[model samples]
Target: MRVLAGLIVASLLAAAPAQAQTVFAPDDPGSSGQPGGWVNDQWNFLPGTGVDAPRAWGNLIAKGRPGGIGVRVAVLDTGLAYADRGRFRRSPDISRFRLARGRDFCPHAGPGEDPCDGEDAYPDDPNGHGTHVASTIGEATANAIGVTGLAYGATLLPIKVLDRDGYGDQQSITAGIRYAVAHGAQIINLSFEFGTLVSSARQIPLVLSAVKHARRRGVLVVAAAGNAAQARVAYPAALPGVVSVGAVTEDGCLADYSDSGPGLDIVAPGGGDDALRPGEPQCRPGVALRPIVQMTYAGSKHRFGLPRDYVGTSMAAPHVSAAAALVIASGILGPKPTPQALEQRLKATARDAGPPGPDQAYGAGILDAGAATAP
Candidate 1:
């Protein structure tokens, strides 16, 4: 299911906390000589509120990988702007990324009564959702174009399970998961969710089996908790062995629209208004916060811009996927870490938030890439 985009009016005013000794200042083109202008818009990477990405960048650089080099993350969504085929064009920020061969599972409708073709080699995004999600994980860094990605050095594998409208069937999603694992993807990011009505695991047995297959193959699966704003987390994310992620705003509280329950594994910056909770200082009921900003389609697939309407658990899941790639590349977990080990490392290093000690709202806590990859 697609989480509807919302507009963000306010800008972040808080100064980021002290950064690490290794500073990474990249020239930002539109900021008018302001070095690393990405810091102004990408509050999700800041020190205090968001996942301190600069520290993680320094840690990865110290290991000589720079940004999760040698790791592969598969994004299963509505395709991506990773290629230039026919009328489609690649996103400018991610033009230099190492993208693996992707498959298009979206079915094409035939004229009259002809059979539909459901598979293709080119997975160009007709919808911008997949491109936005992929850019967050592997958009090029220090290229002086747009915002930096979290795991910029990693290889991205785009698996188009969802169609143009951000909807997909069980068969396509299952195929996409298996395809990701068999094609050498170390991590898979599922930024879409089934409806909350499909509560039980029996409802999606094929998708469940696919998730288990990824786990058995040593591929980490990260999924988004639905944006239903309810206590129950959605399927695929709620499935066992999958890292279920919830959403938090820039204020560090659970986002008003993020789902929370026993199944949630962690939280990250999803960017929206705060949920009103008693005794929580950051919970502002009506105040709209800044949404996650990345280079994506402006109106058509041919044009690109940094739009401020993207938000939801869909935006939160990629942070964990990129962080997992960083953890693998950092060498702190040894050469080949198991999926369980990577999940535990992320949970252990997260900064605590909401109700204390792994509650439903904040899960283990907001994701801290800096702490997870610290040397």
Candidate 2:
């Protein structure tokens, strides 16, 4: 989804772009300045609380499980990093990687390398957000360097749609979706989102056409609900036939900053509005998508040497995406389930989260990775 600075929308608009201050720097590792530790090292967890057992999807990846062999997932974000080659080495086969054949629509903002690639051109991410997100999905965990990905053995296809600023127009996003589906991305993870709605009747055709194409292709699109915290919604996630995700705290309570509305299809662990200091209740069962526990490290540094805690719903979406890979790999789920069938199976089996039932606050309920895999 989105993270907010708690300022009124009007005030946030008035502030200069420099002062607007969005926490999600897709190009950066989210550290203020120096290099941050491995992506999974930042995952937050609640004591005595963990991913649900009987994970229908996650269990598929267990050793010796049928279809536990390597699965492929397409990570649509900024771009993958060679600096983190150590992370990919854990894969049983690393040659499965495919580069984006799409064009980079983002224009250069300043005196830095272009984060967007042109004509098969590759861009270096100065910010590292996309790398972090991709690492979460397929990073070779247990390699003993970076944090473990949900599907460590799964293959990843990197798609860069957003630039260093973490912003992209609808045209670029639509193109990215089509590219992912055509290129064999069974499960599409859209961690990046825009703040506008697709309202025009003319524009509706483009979106509907894309969504229909995905469904027909048997591709499941999982998107993050905006982090705006307001009931008002944003696109792609709010679009028809897409799964909208919200965030939960370590204790399973709705993150105060998480956006809630009729549009939400599910909730996941996005993180908290406030730092989840110890002694707070861990994430409770609710209408969350699969919960991605928050991760933290002691005295981590960003590329520039700034120090700060990293968190967001962007972190949660990958958990669900990788888990889906596990499900698809299980063979029980077959090549690909229709988006509607996949969505229903996930919701029906998710452990109930808030209000003892589905509500706008939690949607279908907290995502139970283990349980979601149950045939």
Candidate 3:
């Protein structure tokens, strides 16, 4: 019986090596895109909303002397997929994109071997969230394909740390952070959050170390406060030396779901109801749970071959990321501004939203891309 059992165990171990590995690659974004000014008379700012309009970042960029013109910003998300409609404008010369690196932290999903597999050297996203976020930060612009980006002139280095489900383990997240810094990425944007606080505490040393290392290398790390809407903060974003961002409405109001605290460095136009009429119920045909306020990207393609709506704190995080790039590109702030100094500059120049001064509800104020870039 023992010999028979041993033989079965050996068989199981040998069969594991035959399993197919999963992989991903970046693909060409669809032809149509937003022009970075205004879509449908309103701004389609958040990810997955799919309306492609000139985002607030556009106004900010226009006012800037010429920010993020020659910089590279790394967007660490699920993956990127350029869309069919003009949700993000294209620029053949200035906007250079690559499926630099990626990993699959989810063991159950499939074998993690996309980029390394050679079958798909670039990471392409079927989920759509990463593509929307990337479009806002650094999609190729003015190619008459998609919507305009916050830093249309900047180059985007896409890295995939999370899986299609939009969740990743700490090890994978840490690896992604390090990889971005190792590459030529000067600005790092992380829009996802994890629930474990103790894990956050455990990861603090590594997170801060990476931040310091990146800063020493003239890189900036920007992350999002958790979308829980509770006062509780999440990892990486909540860590010291990292810039944690919050969300606000178009009228310059604090978003109810945005986390608030000292960690809340600055607020930005995350999303609001301005795109929809008050009584008009923001409904997306087949989706049952309509977001009271649409903020995040729903998806790139739908079952009916259309876009979907996405609303979450995750949606609010990218606006700040783009703004940070502008600050770096402006040359107004000295190169390698400390996290505290960058926070101070942003707050000092922001258009106050909450009470007069820094309050827990709104922090310093909503981010003013224009003012942050003004000489």
Global lDDT scores for all candidate models: 0.85, 0.53, 0.52
What C-alpha lDDT, on a 0 to 100 scale, does residue 167 get in candidate 1?
A: 74
Model 1 reaches what TM-score against the true structure? 0.93
TM-score per model over all chains: 0.93, 0.71, 0.69
Model 2's alpha-carbon lDDT is: 0.53
Q: Give the winner by lDDT: 1 or 3.
A: 1
Q: How many residue pairs clash in each candidate?
A: 0, 54, 49
- Which runs in model 1 stand beyond 4 Å of their true positions? 1-21, 29-34, 110-117
Model 3's TM-score against the true structure: 0.69
Q: Write the per-residue lDDT of candidate 2 for residues 1-375, one digit (tens) a residue.
A: 221111111100111223222111111222222233332223331111223322332355343442224555666666545332322222221223423332333444445644443424443343455555655566543332323345556667666667655765555566767877887777787775555444232554565577678878888887777666767444566777777777666556667656677877777666544322234344333323222322211232122221123346566566667666666666555665666777787777665665668887778877765556655
Better of 1 and 2 by lDDT: 1
- Judged by lDDT, which candidate is best? 1
Question: On residues 1-375, what C-alpha lDDT tens digit does candidate 1 reach at each position?
Answer: 222221122354345457535635556542333667888888898777788888898889989998899999999988889867789898888854488999987666567421224689988888888888898899888888878889999999999887676777788889899999999999999998887667888988998999999999999999998888989888778999999999999899899888889999999988888999888987888986888988889866788888878888899999999999999999999999999999999999999997779998999999999889987
Instruction: Tell me the lDDT of model 3 at 39.
Output: 36
- Report the Cα RMSD per candidate: 3.0, 11.3, 14.9
Top candidate on TM-score is 1
